[model samples]
Target: MWVVTGYAEVSTALTDRRLCKDSARLRAIIDRATAARLDGSRVAETVATDMLNSDPPEHTRLRKLVVKGFSARRIERLRPLVQQITDDLLDAMVARAADGTVDFVDAFAFPLPLTVICELLGIPRADQRSFRAWSTVIVGSSSRDDLRRTTTALGGYLAQMMSAKRSAPGDDLLSDLVEASDTDDRLSPLELVSMACLLLIAGHETTMNLLGSALLALLRHPDQFAKLRTRPELLDAAVEETLRYNSPAPVTTWRYAAEPMTIGGSPIATNDIVLLALGAANHDERFPDPDAFDIERQSTGHLSFGHGIHFCLGAALARMEAQVALGRLIERFPDIALAVPADELRWRPSTIMHGLAALPVRLGR
Candidate 1:
């Protein structure tokens, strides 16, 4: 077995120029178990965006159009609303709980981010179930037939939503993107559709998993959960710690090295695949007792949001959403507990994301 666990090696590899995030990388990797069967066309069609695919200057221009709105300052302004959304979700969960037993994920974790994102995007409340189902198939499992169907249906719906935003602006990211496309970079209709597709899925699914994984970790380590509940101020740090501890999009993303670079003395060729193991990186010895979930740990160096110019554009929004969601969760259900055993829990077999199929949890005070 080959061993590779060091901050320097992983971070250096992630920021290197040798790796690339081209379509070929995903097509081959999506199915080591099934790839011998999928034709290149079928796989290439799944991911349609400049956000997760393509390098600068396409990435640079496309990212610039929306990055301004998601800056730390702007996201900070959105925090109170995030808090409200979190509170509302927890309220619903608490109302539904009977004898202290409730599916915390369905009750709280999943809905918090979904509701916030839908509100932010101005997606109609009535359409959430469809959006959730599509995102579930896209991120939860990677069956070729299922992914294609979800992608097409979801993409078409979001494209229409973007069209609506363009025709009649709203106080949401879609409107902002429409104006950005019209005035600033002149993004074509298809490009805008692709961007919407990226935001809708990436925005919702990642945060959903973040809450689930973080809550699971806390449940497994009840002492830490209590620490968070007792110290309200630790909420922000806890969010970052949870991100580093078990990032939602683990084992994927940041799949580029700009050119040939050497990592751990292993030569990676130009355009080679560079998979940053966020989970492994978080546990690297260089980070000091890496397994410990110390919310107080000055973890600004963490790569849960990634690094360099291509770092996740929505990092601030992600942080704000998770902080409010997790913070409110602990507030409403201080005695929250996992209703299922860890080993018995099923995980999404998607090659791109590391997330649970479902989180069975019960909430109480």
Candidate 2:
């Protein structure tokens, strides 16, 4: 295991040209162990649509295409949509909670990101269910068997959707990617499928967990929750704090050394699996007052969305969605409390991702 103790070291590891993280090479190692559980046929297989699966020129190309759909200007415009989704979910929670009890996951955490991504991607109403199921397996697959079946099925789904877009392009991210791909063949049929899957997994579910993690932390820290409730404008830092306190995907996508490299004074060998601990790096004491959830902590940068050229494309969208969702969730239901004890809420058992299994709560009497 590669140890990274400082922000500088992590940053260097990410941007360093010395390190290599070609997706296929790393996939071989990852699937080697998990292949028995995932289909044996896919044992050496890599995902078709993942950004983490590419290197250099391809990485830069795909990142730029994804960025086109998520520019700061575009994300700023998405604020109203984020707020609208927040309001709609809170309203539904109120309607469902006639007696003042609601599963916060259903009422808020799940729908907010789901709706926003569906709108952002311009997924047809009819195809939403397929996307949802595909997303769950792509991002939330419970077991290896589940991952394989879903991978094949979702690949087919994306291929079919791309064909539809080719005929009748809509005003969604897929269409944008298609148009961009027309000029640049970086997004081939396989890559197109991979990109679609990447969008849903990265663009949707992770944000759901981001909002959920933030809400869960606030509820557990009632004093902090109260402070945020009183000062609604502190949302940006609050969201960043939650990301630090409880990283959604605690371990980033696994990376292996392309060649022998030194990181944090350790000589990592070629093909060594290095799991970047986003949660640990965020809490490094090097970053003054690492644990105190200060709402004004000048949250300049964090690895919650990741680092380097392969940084998250949906980051701006994720930030907007979290700020709007958490800010309004508190504003609308100030008394939102966990139906179960904080200790009883189970965390997803996945080794890579971290999130709640369920988040039931009482909206209030």
Candidate 3:
């Protein structure tokens, strides 16, 4: 894998048409055995057919169809609801920490975003667990067999959900996606399932990391935490800084060279899979003391949500969720601190996602 870690190269790689996102084209360049392995699975094919896996005009069509549902106005309208969810989850965390300590990840970080995304997608509360389990496997699982099995199971569930939506539509994003039909163009059945999988998984998973990592960052930097505690107005800066300090996604999904070209002065090659390290790029020497976590730092030009067309669709929602959850938690428990040594905390085993496995803290009274 040709890894591009410099910010300039990563940014250029994102918008370069030469480095394509077409799944079929990418698969073809891989070893024939691996390509066959991926192609052999129906679940893989279905999930790979979505906007994230395609290049324009297919990507353009899929994006246009989905972007309407996540307009700025619609996302803004969700702020009150997101605040309510955050408050409720914090209330529960308070109760759970009657003993003065609790696993923050279990009580707050995971559930907050999970609940928001489920509600946004109109998924039943009871189904969130299954989806979570499936998503866990798809995102973090190392075993190929396990990944394939969970993806197949998740795809089956989405297929059923889409069928139900067709028979009886609702006022959710999925319904909007289901009912969306363009001028002689519409999302195919597999494409719909793929899109749902993408949204459902990406919606909560990325933000879950953002919340977890942001909290962890604050806890480690008490000075910055206290600064934000005093000036809640710095909440937005804190979020941006956290995104840059430890990008929720350490690396973006792989892109392949469609034709021979040079990157970072490297030799040209067709179909060379390039991995852009968002975390590394965010901390590149291009920025002054990039490793230091400073909310006051100007955090523009970071590749946290990526660059160009494939930038995260739910960036606004993710920001809102993190802002509300972090702001409320800190406000409610000013004395909160790590329950265990900082070094004891374990990060989730994910090369792509940078998140703690659990964040244990004391909710000082």
State TM-scores per candidate.
0.88, 0.90, 0.96
Q: Which scores higher on lDDT, 2 or 3?
A: 3
Model 2: which ten-residue window has the lowest total lDDT? Answer: 37-46
Top-scoring candidate (lDDT): 3
Clash list (residue pairs), candidate 1: 17-257, 17-258, 17-259, 18-257, 18-259, 19-257
lDDT of 2 by residue, 1-365 (tens): 56564677776677776565666665566666563433434321336435666777778777777777788887887889888778877888888874687777656777777777877776765665565566565556467677777787877776777888888999888888887777667677667767777777666677878877888888888888888888887888899888777878776666778779888788898777776777788888766888777666766677777788767778778888888788777777788888878888887656666777788888874
Give per-residue CA lDDT, model 3, range 256-346, as digits (tens).
8878999999975887788999999999988899989999999988899998999989998999889888888888998899999999989
With a 3 Å backbone cut-off (N, CA, C), the pairs that clash in candidate 3 are none
lDDT of 1 by residue, 1-365 (tens): 12334667767756654566655554455445362655555223445555567666777777878787676777787788888877777777767767766766677666777777777778888888787788777766567678777777876787788778879998888899888888876677767777777777788787878888888888888787788888989888888888888878766553644566677887765544566676677777766788888777766687776677667777778877887777767776777788778889877777556777778777755
For model 2 the TM-score comes to: 0.90
Rank the models by lDDT, top first. 3, 2, 1
Name model 3 segments beyond 4 Å from true: 33-36, 181-185
Alpha-carbon local distance difference test for all models: 0.72, 0.74, 0.86
RMSD of 2: 2.6
Off by over 4 Å in 1: 1-5, 24-46, 254-259
